[model samples]
Target: MATSRIRERSPKRDSLDDLELPEDYVPYVPLAKRRAQKYQKLIHKKAGLDFGSNYEDGSGSGYDSNDNYRRKNKDQNDSGRDADEDDDEDKQPLTGPQAGISLIEQSVELRKAQLSAEEQKTDVQKAMEEEAKILAAVAERKQLASAEEISKGIVYKDPIKTTWTPPRHIRAMSEEELAATRLKYHIDADGEDMPPVIKAFRDMKFPKPVLDYLKNKGIKMPTPIQMQGLPVALSGRDMIGIAFTGSGKTLSFTLPLVMRALEEETKMPLAKGEGPIGMIVCPSRELARQTYEGFVGIADMLHKGGFAQLKVLLCMGGINMQEQASVFHGGLHIVVATPGRLQDMLNKKKFNLDLCTYMCMDEADRMLDMGFEEEVRTILSYFKHQRQTILYSATMPKKIQDFARSALVKPVTVNVGRAGAANLDVIQEVEYVKQEAKIVYLLECLQKTPPPVLIFAENKNDVDDIQEYLLLKGVETVAIHGSKTQEEREYAINAFKSYQKDVLVATDVASKGLDFAEIHHVILFDMPKEIEDYVHRIGRTGRSGKTGIATTFINMNSSEQILLDLKHLLKEAKQKVPPVLEALEDPMEKYREMGAAGGCGYCGGLGHRVTECPKLEQQQKTKNSGMSRPSERAGNEM
Candidate 1:
């Protein structure tokens, strides 16, 4: 059997051929045995490495029994220890030479953060300032552009893309259509004497009530402004009427509003005592009152025609709220108020504007100029957004034009008069004088031809002082200012109207909505702050086809820029500059070169009494760069 000791191969021999079977194989090794095997392997492996037999130095067989264990422990300890040693070496104290670089790096990081923070703050502030200036300039350009458009008579087509040319056959229509057309066009005057716009209204054939109102007002003809405005306003469209003073702008909207009101009243009556169906906001108390009066006069004619009850209530400052509140309680069919008083009443819930269907802002340009824009917004917000809006102004500024654009939805703009339009009836004249000669010249003008003149002063104090001086000089004069009481202001207006006072000394308060029917002259005692204001001030006169005269005081000591502005305005109005003040552009500078003393001789160096140097007076150039210097004078004409 020993001679033939070769193992026999089984069918599965190939699969298990390389397997080694241990004589003491256990299903699972014991913990001690497993650990011993691991140590033995470590000893073998470490002994094979260059670290040498120190890893296996103990016990027998050139391999200490403890050698494998010691070797395994040494390897394990060395792995951990070596890693730790490398970290400690890295963490070892830095050399003195490397410290500066570390500190410098940290400082640079800190400075970067600080610089970033400063830059952020500066950027924010600069952005805010730039935004403000941009807004202001944008506003200016817009106003100038609108004025230019109106001046140039640039008309854009309607958004709805409908053709609006009047029918030629209508002119040859039968009696019924012709009558209807005439009514629509508002043929109030004689046929041959009618303006084309009036003829157009006559051809439209509006309702009877509208025609009746027009006829009653003796508006036998529509003005150019009215022709452009009425058609759109009557169509339930928002509108802006831009025309010079006395171009019948008031009638343009007034006739249309009255017609709409009459139509509504005749067609259907409002719920009893609900509220006003319409409202009109004016810039100043005087203007609001006058507008109310005008509304009342026209409304009276409508009432007699069997129309529904139409009433007007006035709300303004310088009056008792109790009286105003009483009016509100009675309920109004129409309201006219300054923004302040109107806003106050609105907040009290005295009357809800939800019922208001029509609104008009008369003198919208002047309202913004007087800084009533916020108040205007407050009032407009109270009305239903669906209501009709009509904005009327003598001249549209960018701020005003923008406001009108936003406030009015899809408005038809009506521009009246010629390009570079001024109240043609107003004869504008600029007077150049020594600062001292102003009062003397004013007094001379008063003595020669003062016919209920309105004198514009730059300040309220100047208004009062001028009034006093005029009175002391035996001239009948009155003043209106912020300080005046409601009664005093109204009384002053009455006095001016009654011809009791031949001259009125006023600041810009008198610039708007002041309708003194016979104002023959406007005297600019001081130049206005804005070029636009020059237009508003002069608009006070030459109203409704009446001729008027405007005189401005240009001093030698005043700014050349202001004088140039005045010159430009006058030139635009097609008026010639008087020769006396033309060459005195830099009066003060010229006088200074002439060795003038503490006071100017022309304007009294002050803007007052000639006893003082005219050139020494406070200059009236609100904006320093656009006007002439104060006049130099040696005597008081008064």
Candidate 2:
């Protein structure tokens, strides 16, 4: 083998000269030479220099021989730098010949100048400039009247007036007395020149008809939310009202909205297709319909009091779009609509918000939770002039606050209790039941309370299954979900409300903003994924100061975080916490002992830190993944 290796050692071959090649094969050019040729051609084309014979022959020597090209293009590469330096001294645009240039050429030059100027700026300078641009845009928008406002004869220059005056007795109260009233009601008001809390319905200066309606409805006293929220809303100030559910939040905004509409109608009779001075945006169709009915009742009262009939329309999905559109032609004084259907109508030119200056977002937190934030913004854009916006919610999470900051200007914040706190009027009961045994245990739990019970499940399928199981067991039951037709949902709701059905099984769609009368019991078939939902679910009972009971079933499948939150909520409300929940370790125990901030500031959920908030994390993931699909959890109530 050694002798064979030493036989012959040929010199290393150079290039392809040592190999036999095909006769038709063209010699390969070196990569550097090929790149040089391409660059030479590009330079010649940009400089408007002709490619001489040398370049045509593939030598690429034409660029060096052109003395005139070199002389003319010597400083062309530095032109942008020179222009940027000149701009630092003088910010004026070029005039004379430059001004006479074609639009295309001028645009190019302007873009170039902008790019050059931007390149020379530091990060701080760029930030300042961007902020200045945004402020200027906002100022410009504020100064200009929208086309809709102009068409409605609204002048942008006129300032919004606070026409609601407190009654003589209320005005006679000293400042200390007013503060004491707020303190007594646990009312916390924050803003510049906050309105004083109203002590009674009489202090709100409601029209006699409204006062009579309240008396007839047996609303003899103002709830805590009404005590503070009514004054803030009636004062024509944008407001964020946070109070526990069933704290009269609906009346706080609805009464003011109706009053404002009545005032506008008195000033100028509504012509066909020319009204809706007040608009209320709700998250679910059921809530929208309920609100519409409430509006109609108030409108009837106003008509009976010798005022023009206030035409109210319910705009929501499932109803015939044509039917809703037909009502718009008769002139609507107030509209209660779900965000999706309202935006659809506005997009179809079925209606406009030109005259709508009073806007209320009921269950504002739920609207945001249902992925209607963008749709809400789109609806707001349709408003022609500044509106007095009122956002009412049982919870004021950071997301809602951020939305408020963007939507309202100089808004007063009214909180009747700590945001997201459960209702003390509800007697909470927690039970441990295996997942497979939940159905059997559900019937047993129903015996704890009487008829007119509300049962909440987390999913639509569960709702249907529960309803069927109850019906099979000889229990009168009704069900509603997003899958139900509009007529079916309405009938089910009315039947339940009228006591035709002893039990109502539903998803989260019915959990929010639906006021059921005399609901003696609320049962959660399974623990909710979020603690906020649990609060709203139990809120079905214990409405309007009536004490009620809420029973929740939890098993191994329930998340520890949710269990921890449930435990804390029970403790906060002085309800009994189950031993199963008490035995679970708190992940934040050490952090709390270290005096670190407790719970999530973003959502007020006691189970997790802000960084570990599931809602926030899911939102971030959705944003990062560029997801555009609406959440299915919003249910069929859209």
Candidate 3:
């Protein structure tokens, strides 16, 4: 294990001078020392190129081998030279060209390596971020899917059971629960035990003016609809009352409203031009005007001694705002306004509804159907939440039901007949014909009816054409549509109601509770697009349990869905469908076979001879899975 290594070689080394040490006695050294030794040896080996500055005495005399040898020995002894050190000296520095080449190559290579390393690091980070985002999105989607499933768990069942079942749970209950289940009989049928409220009304005799007005109208006793509705309304109860057109619902709510307004006027006598005492919002302009007339009749009686000049204003769209504002400015004790123009004027700082304690929505369901829901909500939100809200309509559908449920607080539901069903007094008849023959059939029906008739069309253009056709046939007729100005519409409505014109051709705008008392027939010139509308249209006739006729002009190739709806409605009304019309089967089948349902071939569904599709002819594509769609089913099973 003994070894000897020479430190520096001299020109003369005499004989062998061997040196040995034990392998176990070797000592460890730091890496710093080892690296420095390596660098020094590299520099020394090129000493000829490194040592150019240190010359003796500033003379350019290079040292000889002897002097160099002496200098090396002196430095080694002073520095305690180890045996492992190298012995080259006089190394030289690199030349300018070589140094530049080396620097450029080193810099370029270093930059390339650094950039590659940074790019790799960035890529790894981006991949991690993307993976995290994907996982988060997946988690969110799963949560939404689960929430949808949970929400769809709700089930619907009929509240009034058709089939009977016995109760299985007969166990005894706690006394508190048993007491809670007991029914309270607050309503008494005995007229002898009338409530103090009813007694007070009976005791308070009507003024001479009011009695005279009632006597003129020949209204001796209040109808049942009036009896039930008037008491509750006068008591300031929120009520939803439904009665036939002739059931005197107008008087039911109107009487109480007039009484409230009259009493308020007597007690407070609103400032010369202040807010209305009561606001009655009806669905249509004509209806609103009619309601105002009804209010005037009642107010004339109620306001005999106090506030004899009961100012009632009609605010509805189509009428000039300036005219309405003039009336509103003159001081309105009562207002009968359609929702739109009333809200419009109110928005423009026209009138204040804060003083309106009694609010009644006549034909409330129709108001909702005609897209007046948000407007109604906006109007109601302005009043105090505790205001007496009375909603009157001929029918209440699910939409109206939901709206009432939210808008009214613990409202009393009153229906004069069936829910969402029309009057039984109105006769319903359907005439099945080809689509092209519908116009001819309508003319024939008109010819058969000698009395004043109201024809209901589905669209504005149809109303115009029907009116023109009737006029050309020497029939006295007038048309009312939304396109007409308020003045023209008002004039037309007045003409129809006053019998200046025998027939009024109209759209659904005229359908909502416009009581043209003389209208003994309602001819459905075209089937309504929505089944719900049938109720409102037919309801225009058959006012106050009076017998009336409703004729539906159904084409052999009309919508089967509409026919089905008509059949169902007639069945509910307990009217028998004529066997002739009922034998047509699917209405759309004939139209489909003739390829007209696929469209006119030239005009598609536009029903025109032109080859181009008009701007309005483009209808939205519908999903094809239901019976409502006219297209064929995928499985032929339906």
Give lDDT tens digits, candidate 1, residues 235-270. 566666777776667666666566655555556664
Candidate 3 local distance difference test against the native: 0.59
- Please list the Cα RMSD from the true structure of every candidate, rounded to 1 decimal place: 18.0, 18.1, 21.6
Error of 1 at 570 (Å): 1.9
Model 2: lDDT of residue 73: 32
Clashes of 1: 67
Q: Of the candidates shown, which would achieve the greatest lDDT relative to the real structure?
A: 2
- Prediction 2 TM-score vs. true: 0.74
User: Which candidate, 1 or 2, would have the higher TM-score against the true structure?
Assistant: 2
lDDT of each: 0.60, 0.77, 0.59
Model 3 agreement with the true structure over 499-605: per-residue lDDT tens digits:
88889888877877777776788998877755546777887777755788888877654555556556656766889876754664643344445444222221112
lDDT for residue 560 in candidate 2, whole number 0-100:
81
lDDT of 1: 0.60
Among the numbered candidates, top TM-score falls to: 2
Error of 2 at 593 (Å): 2.7
In model 3, state the lDDT of residue 72.
45
- Kindly report which residue stretches of model 1 are placed more than 4 angstroms away from their true locations once superposed: 1-220, 321-331, 417-421, 448-450, 579-638
What TM-score, over all chains together, does every model reach?
A: 0.60, 0.74, 0.59
What would the per-residue lDDT of candidate 2 be over residues 519-609, giving only the tens digit for each residue? 9899999998778889889999999999999999999998887888888888889899889989988876765655655566657787766
